[model samples]
Target: MEDKIKIHVLNTGYVEVDEALAFKDKSYNPIAYTGLFRSNKHKVKVPVFSYLIEHPKGNVLVDTGWSVASREDYKSHLPLKGYIASKPILPSGENIAEQLDKLGIDKLQFLILTHMHVDHVDGIRDVQDRAEFILVSRDELKAANKGGGRYIKELWKDTIFDRFDWNGEMGPYFKSYDVFRDGKINLIYLPGHTAGSTGVLIKNNGKFVLITGDAAYAHASWENLELPGIINDKVRTLRCLKWIQKLSKADNCVEILASHDPEVKPHIIEI
Candidate 1:
């Protein structure tokens, strides 16, 4: 039998932030930031996506959407304050549970988190009863526990650690992972935006789909190798972008997909 899989992009909401706010460092050319800021300014629609991967064995979710606590905290923070002040509602009325229901996925087999960012891992609590969570590594989980970034460690305080089965690193290249031997799905570590930030590569029906979670917020950012100011390591972020570009070009089977690209929204096929 031939291997098969289906991919879907779920839109969560939109956020507006100043372009300069995204790049706080001065290592790169200032003119570049100015140009990008001016060209892409209005609230950029950010889709909080939860990808459903249907394999022959079972179904898996790449990342969960936002949770009430994270969303409330984010709304109160300065970084996200402006967008919330404007009262811009999230795009979808359906939460992760409802969305999954619409997809007809009764039970999730696996839950893979790209990182511990609030928007990415917020919905984990919602699906805790249904699936086993797969995180970056034990060290990464430790770092998240340190609690300094936008992600709230307390929110995950009740997480059932025993439910976490995978505990190995992806590789030196950012922090790497190979999900399966047959190349059906591979988790690539593209750290920079966050300490243990990662991306996913899925092979479905001969085509390769690359789901980058905040590795590059927008497709143009990756094309230009532009680093976001909020990132923890600019050097590593650029390296990941370069690698993504090469993969999209040289690896004919691969198609790069950004988690928050507004332009790509129209192309998403809802299942």
Candidate 2:
């Protein structure tokens, strides 16, 4: 077997979202949290993270996090004519490229995007030319072109993606591709957060870590079974959540990290 891979959680930046956007049943709508009609002065800051995996075969990254330009002005990347999408907030130099540079890494063998959310793909331009290839699910490419507030394709329209495919079912939806042809790094399909939203399941040091990108707001949501406000399908999202919860209960799942969960700080897992 190949040597275990190391997983490093990189803090790219954060987003300031309406309380309703992260949690459901927390607003006047009853079935929702916050939106234009029930908008409130309250706000929640969620951290943005991208994972760096060190494998003997090659280096891999999951999600690009936020764009560097966002550090200057969070609203700069939004296409709403200055209206922010998720009201991203970041300090200067917290971008993915700089973070990767701090570790003395230059090229990425595989750049896996969890979904097309603005925060996840904004930094692609920074490493697009250097990375060997940007990989994303086939369904994600189609969903991004479907027109939505978060599916901003302009950031990475020029980059070619090697759409990773899998034909069997793993949990609630279509099966996942154990990228690398090993069980250590599996791209689990847990749709609903976005049409093609996916997460990474990594094995290291006899423990498995699931990096759930916006699948659940935080550990609390998954622990308490609370659904987030932003979703493509509530039913499917719930099923996905249950699927993850089931995995968490297993002895191998050491932890499940949420992309924007401030509670889960960045750390390195030795394998």
Candidate 3:
């Protein structure tokens, strides 16, 4: 029998942004997500998470957390506009490289990124040598390379990306990529958060765990069908949330984790 897959939920750092950015409401502010010119005084601090998947085939890491440089000077670490969008809070030993070192993860077979958001990809600099291949969705890479708004080209300029396409329909929107050509680990295209924002579906021993990387910000995101503040396509976001709602009800669904949920802590989930 194959060993159970162990998923380590690692919290690299935290980001403080406007509450609107995490969950959308009736507020009509167009640039609320940017944390600029918003009338609302509400700010929220949420943890940025990275996942280490111990699969039978190979070890995989999903997303890279904040870089250590941000801890010294966030202003210099990010562009002026990017700094205003989301302020990073990285303490000593909270970055991906330190966390990976503590976990004794010397190398990873694949580094699968859910999107190119600054918070998700900024830590790549720390782990570039640790991962053999870095993977991103084809559409995501295109959008990131275009360089506008939240996608900062500087963050991943030196990083070479291996693009993967969706070849089958297994999740919402009828788009999913079986990473290992097996049903155990799949990448579900949950766009709208970004051009190619993807979620992960991990199955082991007849159980499932879904990692919604900003596709839904928290359990309440799909529970109340509340869309995230920043959305490229409102229709697609809603569709993805609805599918998440349905899947959460399945008996085989062990847990659904959101990347920045304050309630989710660093833990090991074996499925």
Candidate 4:
């Protein structure tokens, strides 16, 4: 029986979205993330990451990176506007299917989509069949279904879904879903990046690791209180940033990984 919860960071691939979509007004400013939005499109390769959680109850996956089909064909699965907005690039054998195959993960207990953004949920086509149950922030699911240009409707199109929404909260900062109800794994609500952008908190034997997807683009945003580009609400995003800063201040927090942060690339963070 496995008692320890081990987390493997799977580097599925990368997607290029506008720099402004990443940092607040990175499109134009001296404080630009890369010092300048050189390209007319201002595109940057934000590494796409997924996590495989090996737990006592069952294996769980967080954020599927890209579908193999998308690599082969994008016109069929992605919105034309979104396809142009975020140019996803994947090398041979880097899709979610191959990544899971490399790890010999045939099945999963849970599949958590941090948000509905194309980079986060597009890979579902590659691994959705093996997931036992899905988890999502209720508001996110609603927003994705609203037919936004930022999301790929084809990803969830015509597919039946079974999901448990994260409806509970911890203190004033986080609304969470307590998986296993043992305080080991919590899907935290951190709105502002989207209507339902959320993070995950995992603890085992007193060690902790929290993964926030696009809640902050990199350590810079979360650590320095900088804002990301594609924001829904400035007020909400700032409040969420403060919450993250507060949580990171905890002595027990081992590491905080942002979805697109290059520093955390393809690294397994143990809990």
Candidate 5:
């Protein structure tokens, strides 16, 4: 096995929404997350990120970002509810498939989806056949397949995905899956953002780095226990945020990243 794991953080595109969508405000407006019914001044744009993990066993891609079709016409690529809530801005050459091709990555051992949100899985069509296995947590798959809100089946209707349950004990909730059957890579359950939202944890020697996929929208989400505007369960969101905060303080944790933190730029993280 390789002595180190290299994580390439790629910014595939951007999503424009109300500021409240990224960080909830004091107002309990149910539709605050949707940019509609709000002033244009409240709009904020944040980058959409995906990770490429170079592991000794195999290469894993987490959450394919916006598709080129979105850049052309998001309305045609996304459902009415989705396009209304958030606007996707994918620049030329930023599509997930385009990035992979630029990196000379024609295939992947695993393609994992943290959750089935439109911005995260819309590009599945571009790389579905490139992966040997494409997976999502059983709970997430069940929730997404219901086909409502942001979980639209149109995003992955033609793609086949394997579902895996969280059977291993690890992380804050003791609910995780050891992806490579080794301690190096793990999928930690972090619900609330979705029924089965997941975070990726990569460990090497005594160091570790966590990819918090929308479980925590930004550093402040965990640091201040601030919740995002869209949430499935308030209690679960709080629990996940608190645990992430604690995990961030661990000596072994080299880094903890959020999926759409504007402050985070595309870079490489090694563990």
Candidate 6:
């Protein structure tokens, strides 16, 4: 019998942050920034998503949406717009726990993070009790701790790492590896949005899906191989985008999903 797979895209909230402000001035071409602003009206409403995957072999979570506290913490960082746009609400009409319950999954076998960004890891505490967290590498945790990573320090204050006895598994970096040798799911390294940003590839019932965590905010960016204005490493980020484009075009069954694209959010199949 063919294995069944269910996927859910849990929306945290809508955000409108300036992409140009995210990076240092003069680090990137003004044309790219100008084009993004011109095309997106100088602002983008990003849909923060957390994915829940259920397969016959195991239950997994691709990313975790921000918690209420974490959302508050994000507000603290943005004094200008923080007060106006800061709250914890899921667009899918259910909290993370409630959503899991609806799916009939009491506990998740693994919680794979695409990266340790604030919005993505904010819901970690909610699932810590019921799942083992998987990250791309220890470098991500280290970057998070040092306050040099994507997530701010205030959001990390209540991380579930301590509860897991501080034991977490990292990486399948710069290469593709099967989560289970049977090849039900695969983690592909596509760094540059962060030091260890990764993507999840799942195959079930003859369909393949690729969940890219912040590697590219929109599918158009991936198609154009356009790096985001606020990337840590320009070369690496561009390379990753190229790789995703190649994969998406060559493989008919592969669907590339981004974390913050509002256009793609509505089309996602809720589990």
Which number leads on TM-score?
Answer: 5
Model 1: weakest 10-residue lDDT segment is: 80-89
State the displacement of the C-alpha of residue 268, model 4, in Å, after optimal TM-score superposition: 1.4
| lDDT of model 5, residue 49 | 96
Candidates arranged by lDDT, highest first: 3, 5, 2, 4, 6, 1
Q: Rank the candidates by TM-score, best first.
A: 5, 3, 2, 4, 1, 6
lDDT of 6 at 84: 32
TM-score of each: 0.77, 0.91, 0.96, 0.90, 0.97, 0.76
lDDT of 3 by residue, 27-135 (tens): 6466777777765467778999999999987889999989988888888888886668788989899899999899899989889999999899999988988888898
For model 3 the local lDDT of residue 23 reads 84
Number of backbone-clashing residue pairs for each candidate, in the order shown: 5, 2, 0, 6, 0, 1
Give the C-alpha lDDT of model 4: 0.79
Q: Model 6, 140-254: lDDT tens per residue? A: 5666667652455564465555211112132223466566566667777677888767787777666677788888777877776766666777788878878777777754455
Model 6 shows how many backbone clashes? 1
Which structure is stronger by lDDT: 5 or 6? 5
Q: Is candidate 4 or candidate 5 better by lDDT?
A: 5
Candidate 3 achieves a global lDDT of: 0.89
lDDT tens per residue, model 4, 159-203? 556656655676235478887787888888888889888888898
Worst 10 residues of 6 by lDDT: 162-171
Each candidate: what lDDT?
0.62, 0.79, 0.89, 0.79, 0.89, 0.62
